[model samples]
Target: MKHPAFFKQFLITICLTFFLAPNLEAQTKRIKRPKSSVGISSVDNYVRNSFDLYDKVYKYDGYAAAGTPLDDDDIDVLEDALDDLALISESAPDILSSLDGQNAFKKAKATLQINKANKALKYSVKTAKELLAGEREREKDDDDSSESNENSDEESDKNINNDNSNDDGEEEPSNVSDGLEVYSKYDFVPGDKILFFDDFSQDFVGDLPSKWNTNGSGAIVKLNKVEGNWFELKAGYRLYVIPDINELPEDYTIEFDVLTSGLSNQTSSGARLHIVLSDTNAFSNGKTHYAAVTLPLGQYAAFNINAYNHFNGKGGMINSGLTADIRDEVKNQPHIAISVTKKRYRLWVNEVKYVDIPRFIEELDVLNYLKFHLYGLKDGEERVFIKNIKVAEGGVDLRRKLLREGKISTNGILFDSGSANIQPQSLGIVRQISQVLMQDESIKLNIIGHTDSDGSDEANLKLSKDRAAAVKEALVNIYNISADRLTTDGKGETQPVGDNGTTDGKALNRRVEFVKTQR
Candidate 1:
């Protein structure tokens, strides 16, 4: 049965709120809420609407207060009520921002109303979320289908494909999970051959991405903080966004970067960013054979990140609700890495390996496509964006290649656009190679850099030389390799491995080569 657009948004909203709002009763009891504003009727309505629900919550006891689960019909009613609240959350800022105080009374009213709205939003959001979480425990227990049971908790992904934001890079950096040195054990590696790569640079802002298909709505956006373009993901129940990458070999890796906002302890949790591996490219979740890895975004620190998987049409279970708590790291823009090697599956958030399971992926060849499914998040309130998605064939063992062939050329080393500055994540490749130099004191290397044919030949030539010099610098300063042991060279775009006309081709053309020589 096809659901109206309204119902689809409810899918993840309730689930996220289920976890985000931990204590509703205490949350709703604001010590001293001020009076409503004089000129803003909408503000008054928001307060009244939230208060009505608040009254019922305290009156008959909340979903947990009275010690009983709400009926299925009641759950539907609450969902409908949440829809109205979401609209109020989006529109309230506009209404409140427009309020001007021409006089003392007017200014006082503005201040009072702002306080009222903030408290009401917090209380009401908590009430709805906690009720959803506390009430639906039984429902979750009874539910067997993979649909509702997905381990998802994200701030609404409603901004990826939308270009309507006033964000400049001035906002403080998101709370990044610290101590990356602990994640040195991150073992997943990308494939050597590029299959699909997109940074959204080819797409225009405020337009839907050209190479992606979605049953829901999203658009391309450029932000002041992050470099390049990103796709804003809209939220809906069971809504799937399928990328243009069509074929996936049995051994391949998927990597992407994610950014989020409007997540806090006061907000509700409602969606999971579902990275799915399917047998078919259709809109459905591939009923016959599929594997999905769930990512919970935008939750409070009290909750641990959960990894839930649906394998071979619900016939098996490897793990669910693992204690991989990345709530802090996730909100701070983490580089996500996933590798599928034959039948094994592994995932890492930033530098930490969070999940690894043998036999988790049942059929390696049947998983041919990749897609994303997300549930409810209020439009304009919560947001998630993604960029730099690379799907490549399984990588060769570079260490082995270096020892055997005396040289290794790789595209895994990345740099900032239009510059030779190496991205922090790209240091992993360098770190691995540095180990090889340490193990064999007699080995020395000539570092060579190459680029695609996008700029002037002179500029490209100089940029490649600078890049190779940068690699040599990293070997000396960061990895402690002797500077005398390395030589630097640049071929620029003269030596091309793939076509420059296409994304993958261009990605392959930009390479860094390490050639071993006598010390």
Candidate 2:
């Protein structure tokens, strides 16, 4: 017969052991290794190789570099590798959650980092090559100019001495380096087709295909389908149309098929396909910043974009000139390819490369508006058929090629309290954010403040708002970010990033986020 106190204590211990044992076991299970390996092959191997390449390249040069002579082939390879690595990295949380041993996954991630580094290295080499080529060309031109001057001086002296001046004595200087051209020739593996033409059978908001919106003509996109495909409005001409405004590398390739019926003489105006860079929505009225390609009914042209000082009226959209002639070619069957690198923009008709525009524009201001459809002038019934559209980024170096071009930063501060005041210890974090913002004037940000579910809804909302405002004030008053450029919002407890029950969950929930809003 055991004492009553001892028996009660034993019972309590049994109950706790029964309930808490599985939880501890579950935690251990979460970290366990998977039985089957996520094999390293094909793109995985490429990633590994990329990391090795980056290590070697960076060892030679302190900073990563960009690729030279941008072309389709190399762009494809680099983009494919980036896509793979991005997919893998994005899926990491899910994989870790399901697996018992997450150590292997970490190893895989290590491999991915290496691959990214290598891609950067490749780009750096490309950029170096371009610089070297440009330098050599300049040197050669200087030499030729010197020789021509010497000849002219000799001829002038002779004329003065003999009094026999002849116009025929002047000779046209030969362009010795005329044929010296560099072309990027690396080929990329074709990417998996993520988008289908059928998917756009209905109009919708940016990126989200399921969320439908009425078209510019107050008609739903689903009702405007022809031959099982929805009619897509030209990028610039349509009042409301889906725009492909995604961030892209400085050197990349864009290819698509355009099917169009010949334009009607009365209403046949060409549409503009714009590649803009800034933070604003290009489709909105009076958008100021963008770089674009205007494809007329029978012609193509390029433009350099800028914005007016004031936001009251439509900003500048200055047209450069017609790049090529396409009058002989009818619409609806032609495959068009536009390839851009750090040096030039090249256009291709069908498979034949035609227009090679030299690198006139260095950095387009509005990179966010990379893709758009320009509408033709005629309204009766001109349709452009698009198919097999592809985008790719190329080069060998990973860090320089993808990460640097992407401009992704991983430095920021996280707070545990939901109050608006900046804690004394968090001064360093505030300074870091301010410094980065100051350094990149072109950079814009979305500052979001969040809170855990500990206080009343109204109080939390105000607190979050106050916190975001506090951060914004600090940035503006202390750091000097223009009030107009910075957009601040407080979501309060409405957007809890993690669970509210656990301590770690609460920690993650009470946070502020700064997302780069501009290119």
Candidate 3:
């Protein structure tokens, strides 16, 4: 029996009561606080009040300054200041609040200065420690050098005393006072007068006069004056040789005696007493052939036959091809004997047969016209002695016996289609070619490239050029073959090995050929 206005007012009252009831219960649930005798209890109350004020200032200032980007250093400083201010507010909030804003900022600046000073002191101490360590290392190096010098001086004194003692009595055959004994087996050919001592002594110095020159270090040829049967050829050098020869022997044997004063750890390139016989005219025109026995002091000796035409400004055979490590017992006082015939090359060191390259002479025509020269190599100022130089001849014809072995196939592989890229599978064939070249230094080659008729003549021509270039690159880059020694040409479809009618024939048509440019 209520009016409409009364009903609406009653509904509004019920909704309001429902919302307000939860909040009122929450308030009633709070624990009652005890009465404090010291005002606001401890620092917890002060910290809360200060935080409220800090939030207002930070919000208004936008973290100290409006629109300023905070770098890492700046952020660190602000964080540290906030932590300190929080601690102060907790313990002494009333005093902190009583201070002026300027005074608070001054306190923060003082704290930052102290931190910077501490960091600087740490760096200064580190720098001082490094300087001390450097001085200590330098002192250690000086001590080591002094010790080494003293050892060297002591050794030199010992050597001098020994020499002085030997000088009084009958001197033992010192390396510098002895002459080497030379002998030969071959009878001289008709119209041939062998010169025994042709500039063998050190008659000329500096760069080896005329045909004689050196390839490596310590290359000298000198004459030594001696008493009694000791006539010494003082060779104070590392590697010395006569590059050019005017005449060469068809059959001969050369023997010599060598005495080395000292031996080095470095391998001698090809040090020996050499009788180099070559056609001097042939050498000037780049067509030279020669054979010699290389006596590596303190090491094993070997006989070699070389027939290659070296152009001007090009390094000769001794510099590039010779490999002899003469730093052993045999290097001190060794007797070397080399005998050459039409077919065989033999070498003996101290009555021991060291090299027997059978039919080596037949491999190349080394003895046409002949010249004789003496060469020695010393890596430094070390001295060497040569005695007993002789030449004669009587040897086997091993070349005639090994003629069949010379006919071994030197054929190589061919390229594919219109591409210049060499297939990985072709490596075997390329390696065979490399082996042939390496075995015979005198051999010059013409590498020819060809193509099948599948492509146009012009395209095939270009393809052929690319294929030749690719092969050359493989040999020179991958195999370490000398670029100067290689000659490449492309014939395109002009030269075919087989018919172009079928797949097999087309494959055969695309091939490369290796032709010997020299005998």
Candidate 4:
């Protein structure tokens, strides 16, 4: 019935801790939102509110980076602020980008601060969430110390039904180390042009994503056992949650990560996570046609691919047919990749291609939008989550572009913000580039890295150079490309291919170019 109002009267932010149940049970309270003068755009009021959260995140990073934990009360308030910021980002992601390249002098000064804050936000959020989860667990122990073991065992039993995991009463580890070398044979090249990308970082922990429409219902959720925000889909027959992608071009690639939770030995074999590509973006399967790729959860279950109401082609695991643990992927989190080039369709779960049909689609330009269908699962008892849904266009050959044009610039090669660490998935573009060098011994390249106008000019330049070196290292070590045949450089934020104000524009500006060297 009582609360202390810190920092006089400027109470600005708080996250609803309702979702932190079974672990943390903190009461919702206002946090001190520091005043910020970072005017990102015309919306001064909006920018101030976001920068306030950014300031909090900046301080949290200091606490976490120094290996220091926050007091319980302070940590709770910070968690609330993060939740609030996530909701704001869901609606207006542009607001999250403080530097819009509006005024040259002002933009340059603000970008340095904004970029550092952006990088810190991620580290601080993870540390704070982990602390909150610890607090929640401690509270649970205090509430009922006697029943702790019993409750944990019961929770583990609800994990997975694939039968690969014995009822050992241990939860799966959160951090997964799925390496890249396994994907050496994986040739699913992503589109050169970005279409739609949603890690659900913009959405609040318990709200529906801003870029999706569903006939049934689903919520964006954060797991204590795992990191990142995931969309937990509710199941029903013919129910679909569709992303707000405008249309699918003739050639494009789609990639997303899937993880399963709350399954047991009694789980039904019929439960499956269905991915549908349809002509219309609405709640219905196309009247004329729709293509589907189905991933089954149960062991000895068939994974299916079909062109709705036309034909179905499938590959499955039956008794005595498969040897690998089906439960490993579902629990450990698996990456799914789909590449559609006109009539030809190819789908891969991790590195393995489940479907590759030359004439998978009857028509080339029929499929336009994306739909997700979850079939035959108890909503509360069994749960499935999907994150990092990326749909991009133009997976065309790059060898010709190098020879005919003497240069290749691609947005497909990706890295973390202001970091040299390249994403494992982005290697597909690099793989193609390496082929050109392999085919002809005389070929040499200058790998140049670029970045969006986020951080300071100096920091961005160093980051870009480091990223270029990382790509070159990958080529020499992984693809066996010679180090002597390659040179590296970074353009930083100097070259602007797209407007820094919008999301798509920023994605375009952050690219890697390979230029053929004149010997």
lDDT of 2 by residue, 1-519 (tens): 124464344445434443443422110001111111122223333443444343332322221112123223333333344445455444434433433443443344434333333434444454333222221112235335535644554454333323322243321211111110110111211111111122243445233233223245322233211222334443335444433535556666565444455454443333533333334554443254444454555333222121112122343333355445453333324445565565456655443455455643334533443434455444536544443334545322222322245332111122323445453223334455555666667777677777879889987888777777777776676556787767888888998866777443554566666666756
* Residue 423 shift from truth in candidate 3, angstroms: 61
What tens-digit string does per-residue lDDT give for candidate 1 at 1-519?
A: 224454445545554544564643322222222221233445445555555554444432344433444555555665555666677677766665555533444434444545555555555565565554443222333223222322110111112212222233111212122222333344555678888898888888999888889987999998764567889888787678888877888888888988877766544554567788887888766867777777776464444445545565675565566566666555767788888888888888877777788887776677888988765566788888888899989754677778889998889877767567665556667777888898898899999999999999998998899889988887786778998899999999999999988877889999899999876
lDDT of 3: 0.41
Off by over 4 Å in 2: 1-231, 234-240, 265-279, 284-288, 298-319, 364-366, 395-519
Per-residue lDDT tens digits for candidate 3, residues 141-220, read 43355356445544543343244222223222222211111111112111112322222333334333333334433233
Estimate the TM-score for candidate 4: 0.61
Candidate 1: segments with Cα more than 4 A from true spot: 1-186
Residue 394 CA displacement from its true place in model 4, Å: 1.2
Order of the predicted models by lDDT, top scorer first: 1, 4, 2, 3
lDDT of 4 at 510: 84
TM-score of 3: 0.29
Q: How well does candidate 3 score on lDDT at residue 9?
A: 48
**Candidate 4 lowest-lDDT run of ten:** 314-323
Q: Is candidate 1 or candidate 3 better by TM-score?
A: 1
lDDT of 1 at 273: 79
lDDT for 391 in candidate 2 is: 54
